[model samples]
Target: MGKKSKKGQSRGGNSQKKTGQKAGSGGNKKKSTAAAAAKAAKAAVAKNTPPPSPEKAPVVPEAVKEEAQNGAVAEPVPAVEPAEDSKPTADDSGLSEGVEASLVLFTESQQTLIKNLCSPPSNQAHLFDHWRKPSGVVSPSSEATNNVKRKFVAQLESMDASYPDGGLVGYISNAKTLLANSKSGVNPLEGWKPSVPTGQMFDKIDEEFEKVEKVGLNEVTSCGFVLVAGGLGERLGYGDIKIGLPTEMATETSYIQFYIETILAYQSKGDKKLPLCIMTSGDTNDRTVKLLKENNYFGMDEDQITIVQQGSGVPALEDNDAHIALDPHDRYKILSKPHGHGDIHALLYSKGVAKKWLGDGIKWMIFFQDTNGLAFHTLPLALGVSVKFDLAMNSIAVPRKAKQAIGGITRLENEKGEQRTINVEYNQLDPLLRSSGFPNGDVNDEKTGFSPFPGNINQLLFKLEPYSAALEKTKGIMPEFVNPKYKDAEKTVFKKPTRLECMMQDFPTVLEGEEAKKVGFTSIASDLCFSPVKNATKDGVALQKNGTHPGVAASGEADQYAAVRKIMQSIGCDITDAKPATYSGITIVPGPEIVLKPSFVSCPADYKVKFPNPSSIKISARSSLVINGSGVVIESLDLDGALVIDCEEGASGVISDLVVKNDGWKKVRDGSRDNEIIRMRGYHLD
Candidate 1:
């Protein structure tokens, strides 16, 4: 056993280094065969079904290694294709590197066996000549089941060091154990567990109906809004505030203007304009504020818009305080990458932002991404639903039609036996389980009878107090890190797969047992869910000038145009042909009175002309030049690509539509001795 352990570790190490090492390259073939038989026997015993004698174990075929290696570079094998009526298989082209190998290598036979076990009698393969259990564990008593549970726990703990980080086998096995023995009173479902049916996870429309009958919208005084504009806009290979990307509907509104307008829409649903805040990073602060003033704060009254810094931190594994260590270049390049947005909880609380909002009577905080303009900003339907369910955390779920996308919330057992909502990303689902058509498998435990939910949308609303408690608990418990796959662009062959340290689920961590029970989450299917704008063109594949319908328009909608469209639709305007003019910069007021005039001003448009609300403003041009003036207009320039505008208080300027190969270091030469805020914007061809 010791020898086999060392051999397994050595193989894993080698596999980690070689980009495409053949599985059969080394002469450890004999050892692996012996180990597989032994491990399979042990697993069978542990599962308490049957055990196989040495003679009955599958013969160690020398050709197996050759076949395994061939499989490495083999063309897609359709022989083992999932049964048509079994389960829907997600198109797995988007799977990250190493996940499949790490998962499949450890349990290939088990997966095959499980498939056979569940197969219809007609499709049954020859049964394995094996025994069910070496020992009996038939007792139904909690004590007896606990004894079995302990053995399983021990097995898991023992394998942690050998398996790759975030191995799915360990996760699944643990889940199974929790389900099996969870009938004991220790289960969370019977207590403060949030995923409990009556707790955090409530029926959406049903709950709202109750709330409407009770409290009513007029009595619902609390509102919350979260702004997630912290990521760098480098996906387009541009080094500027992606939030500042300019796109105009037929009305000519900018992205920033659009996002603010959406918030105002939410405010309009309630009594007053809600307290709004922006989560800014070091890379985007100066430009974010400049744009804020440029558009008259999106018609936000003074003191309503607040800016909070999302302070940087070190990665969980790095054991350092700084999350990003700059590169050698003076340009301040990114290092280990930003800690996942899960870290945002710590940022909000530690920075006192949460306390500030709570003191201001804000009971709920809606956390959403900035690039998703279509995020159902603040619909009465959603808010009312939230209040009715009394959900601690509520998310909006869209259909999971794409296999490449992350899996939504599903019920998973914590250390304590209660079922709770734990987010499983796309890669986390069992390939076999997902392929088996049980997207939401029989997650229920015979013991605890506690089953949570599946599929968690990124759009979340949490009550401030419970959220604060969860955030406090999360600090001591680092969530399991799922190392996803990404293209290693720096390698000689860019196609090679590399590990990305980010966790896409990005849900808050909870202490593995009953402590996690306090965090309940619910989901609802809503077409008004937010969609991300990632590219610059309107093929619905990239970012562009118009807004996307909830599921319509795959790409090209500027955030502003999208937000305006939502408001127009919310207020009963037929948005079918209400295209915001190109750069029709928007100014939002919760009231229905303010109307915006359409404009077709080009890039380098003046800040004042686009937004007449603020008497003063500043201007910063990312690429093309800007001229101060009454109304903004973009003059023809030698460069053209994408442009971002950064402006200051009490000032307006004109921008030009020019795509500069580079943001040239040109001198403004305007001799002015004023502490006026001079903002900067950038232009690039993405």
Candidate 2:
């Protein structure tokens, strides 16, 4: 094992490479079984691969060198036939002395892999066409280039042996198609017609769904939850993993804690421990893991949690030619960005988490994004709708006005009669509508009072078996689109680098025809189901007047408080709706602040069982009530100040006609507050 480990550490076992040798003459032939898997395959490898300069010869081993050679040399997708024009010499530097300096860094088999990965028939060929040379080229150039020589050489040495060939090829193929479409002035939806889908509205979900929620409640044991928390909190002015930020000002619980506790709350009602899979990216993985370890998985059983880090980022492209982009400040590095949250699906599939869930009797997969604050509040009914309709996919939606920044779920039919139900990004929907016969484009519906197309919240649920099977067929790769901001009308240069991006919501874009019908949506009231802390404090304020949503920490905390207050008001409690107020220059949503545990009221019908209230519950202005236990009973309550009742899981508390008149935790504008949520809300305790 040690020998193999050392062998793996060396560059594809092509160590101690003594140079000054001629090409095409095999001075040292380190044979890879994969490159020489068969007569025809060896021919392919030899045709694409450059020869080695070492003295060793005829060194063919019996074991296939998959880790070193992969399928780069022997296989062909043949989207286009390999030709001389498709070779790396498209940059005219393939034969440069500097190229040879970079080439000998890898074993001959590894070189063969690199060549095939960038050459013709391989769709990534164009990426090498515009670069001064392929990624590893180290030629005599500018002073800056010389300074980064060692770094570039290291990049060449560490070339991925396990890079996903299929995904890279698909990406290049998509880019080429998009480039052509742009040049020809063709639209992706050229022959397609878009229409609004009357998805099942939970607001009006037949009174029969009270039974549906129960059925969903029963199915909780067979479900696994996924949290897509790959992003960082940089946009929110925090320096940690986004999930590590406090969700609300009251409990200061991290978003991950809220999710885990919510799952645990439902787990209590079921017989099994439902597994949780969190998808993180390179940016957040270490911090996220440390957070989980420090909190002991946030009360989750160690065995019940799985963290899957996202695959290596997709390469950013510089222009329509799809040349791989280099880091602007450091040319030695490839500029790679998150492949987008859509990678969560691919990660789950690649890690075999989805398959294991299925074998573990988990029949549903609930996928939600980070720090929404209302996903768990809305998940139960959505899951029920999935089970109720036997849907392969369910996108949680909220009422949307036309042209809102949020993507809208729409059903589309192509000229060929093939159909799909997917989220049409706001930018695309208006034009699609104009082209599809609506002259006004994206106007409100007279009957629905809003756009018939509901806004996509990016929270989705999938039936496990079909979901897993579909992913298996595609190897978990979603449809990817690249949007390059061309610096020219000819579309030859990019103003900035761009990469292919895919959305988790776009997962259903893969299903079509009758399979597409199996994909639908569930529209819930936005106030009750969607309050995401995604924007910065300032950006939220800009969108506050838009009536769509502010989507920041201030709005998120305020939304949490408002949600609970409405629940209380619905149950005959005189929960006063406070007028819109300001907290450190940001508009606080109008409502009383009421924060409670997930167990405080599982549903509106659940409060009666917990409190068994008789009458007289009034929470007035300048006051907030926070409840943190399922065992807490509230008979009659009147509060004019912050009244916090915190109880442990096994503990109980009873507050009868309790009243508080003193000053509560004031919303003092403390810029030095360590708590990010409170800091962003511009407040902290005295």
* Top TM-score prediction, candidate number: 2
TM-score against native, each model:
0.44, 0.79
lDDT per residue as tens, model 1, 608-675? 23533322221122222222222344333232212223343345555444334433222122212121
Least well predicted 10-residue stretch by lDDT in candidate 2: 1-10
Model 1 misplaced stretches (Cα beyond 4 Å): 1-221, 237-239, 268-273, 294-296, 311-334, 377-379, 402-404, 431-455, 473-508, 511-527, 536-686
lDDT of 1: 0.39
Predicted candidate 2, C-alpha RMSD: 15.1
Clashing residue pairs in all predictions, respectively, total 76, 0
- Return the lDDT, model 1, position 393: 53
